[model samples]
Target: MSRFDENKFRAVTWVQRHIANPLTRRLPFQTVLETTGRKSGLPRRTPVGGRRIGREFWLVSEYGEKSQYVRNIQADPRVRVRIMGKWHTGTAHLVPEDDARARLKSLPRLNSAAVRAVGTNLLTVRVDLTD
Candidate 1:
């Protein structure tokens, strides 16, 4: 990564981690992705934006592997997602071949717009709702 990209990533991630995420995660309408903390072995919830279709939920990770939640997912694919105040257990799959830009087009607009604007290494994630 170039110096500019690295700097931008640091700035954006800081704001999201400290400010945006804390506020949004508490909202009942906001989608929350829950993962087992790789080190702490505790549940970690992150506010995300995605569209649920049938038994699948699709989302884009703005920071790819650098995102803490994505790293947690890598350690443990088993996860839970809260949608409309309901939680569902699922498995998260990282699709490197998928075009994240195109995938974002089919997701929730406001969040997608933010993701597209601030994302440096966009990656597609699909979660299969098992129950």
Candidate 2:
């Protein structure tokens, strides 16, 4: 799986720049989900790449099903996914589409120098936008 991540490092940097940085963050690309921790019930925030599907916003888990966000979704479907400054509330779903699967396979590579590079093959989980 990692062999496919030619730019795992660069991709991580891109993700951090888009998701972690405060000034340059934007939506439908660099987004964060503010949700409650399942066990602690405390607020937990996770950065994610989101897609717009029709009138509703959509999100996919590019990392895997074991991610904390996935667990959070299972615990409580109610969630707020933030993109850029604007945001939307939504529920998580498993869309199970070929395009989504292809997108997962086509993730941009990370630069070799970027710290904390990623290599694991991620799974996509779709998010259904809510009012």
Candidate 3:
């Protein structure tokens, strides 16, 4: 089987569709965030795991460094997110080394941390939206 089998995928889908709600947005921590490429000028949207910090938000992707989304965010922090029938536009920033490390620790999933360990090699963009 792949990293996550069909059953796991189905369960994840069910959770993303029904179990996760506004009241418990935290339950479904991952989302499909959209952004534009800086150089290519191509439209791109990818599902990634993100976390909200006080007012700002951060997304940690496995392909943070070479990913076009990462490059696009670096070139321009402006971004939009669609979740729970709401659209948001905001400014994004690259998380400093210290902050990135701390964030990796807070993650309950070891897999997430392992992925984040490559964070320095990748790009971690922090998006801040009014909504």
Candidate 4:
């Protein structure tokens, strides 16, 4: 990555981690994805924006594999997602073959707009709800 991209990534992630995420994750209506910490072996919940379709939940990760939650998913695919105050268990899958930009078009507008604006390596993740 170029210096500019690296710097941008650090800046954006820092804001999300320390500021935006902490606030958003507390919202009762915010969609949350709970993944096992890759190394910590504890549950890590992150605020995410996605749409549920049938038995699946689709979302775009702005930072791809670099995102902490994405790395957690890579380590353990099993996850729990809270949507509209209800929790659902699922397995997360990273779909590199999917067109993330096109997928974003079908998601919630406000979040998609932000993702598109700040995302460095857009990646599509599909979670198949088990219950």
Candidate 5:
């Protein structure tokens, strides 16, 4: 990565980790993705913006594999997603072949816009809900 991109990534992640995520995860109506920590053997919940379509929940990771939640999903696809105040179990899949920018068009607009603006290596993730 170039210096600029690396710097941006650091800045964005810092803010998300220390500020945005901590606050959002507490919101009752906020959508949350829960993944088992790859190394810690604990649940890590992240506030995410996505919509559930039938049995699948689709989202784009702005930082791709570099994101901690993505790495956790790589370690274990089993996950839990909270949608509209209800939790559902699922298996997460990282779809590298999908057109992430196009996929974003189908997601919530405000998030898509933020992802488009801040994302450098966008990646699509689909969670197939089991229940």
Candidate 6:
């Protein structure tokens, strides 16, 4: 990564970890993705933006593999998603072949705009809900 990219990464990470994550996780309307920690073996919840259709939830990760939650999903696909205060179990899939920018257009607007603006390694993810 270039120096600029690295710097942006740090900035975004800091904002998400310290400010965004704490507040968003507490919001009842915020969608949260829960994955088992790859190293610590504990649940890790990340505030995400997505919409559920039938038995699937679609989202685009702004940082793709670099995102901590995405990394956890890589280690363990089995996950849980909290949508509108309800928890649902699912399996996450990283869709590298999909068009992330286009996928974002189909998702919630506010998040899609943020992701498009700050995201450098965009990638698509799909969660297949089990129940």
- Candidate 5 lDDT, tens digit per residue, 1-131? 78898999999999999999999999999999999999999999999988899999999999999999999999999999999999999999999999999999999999999999989999999999999
Q: Which residue ranges in model 2 land beyond 4 Å of their true spot?
A: 1-29, 96-100, 105-119
Backbone clash numbers for all candidates listed: 0, 11, 3, 0, 0, 0
How well is each residue in 53-129 modelled by candidate 6, as lDDT tens digits? 89999999888899999999999999999999999999999999999999998999999999998899999999999
**Clash list (residue pairs), candidate 5:** none
lDDT of each: 0.95, 0.58, 0.59, 0.97, 0.97, 0.94
The per-residue C-alpha lDDT of model 6 at residue 114 equals: 97
The segments of candidate 6 whose C-alpha lies over 4 angstroms from its true place after superposition are: none
Tens-digit lDDT track for model 4 on 1-131? 67887899999999999999999999999999999998999999999999999999999999899999999999999999999999999999999999999999999999999999989899999999999
Runs of candidate 5 with Cα error greater than 4 angstroms are none
Task: Provide the lDDT at 4 for model 1.
Answer: 89
lDDT of 3 at 114: 52
Model 6: how far residue 32 lies from native, Å: 0.3
Tens-digit lDDT string for candidate 1 (1-131): 78888999999989988999899999989999999999999999999999999999999999899999999999999999999999999999999999999999999999999999888999999999999
Global Cα lDDT for candidate 6: 0.94
TM-score, predicted candidate 2 vs. hidden true structure: 0.60
The superposed Cα distance between candidate 5 and the true structure at residue 113, in angstroms, equals 0.8
> Judged by lDDT against the true structure, how good is candidate 2?
0.58
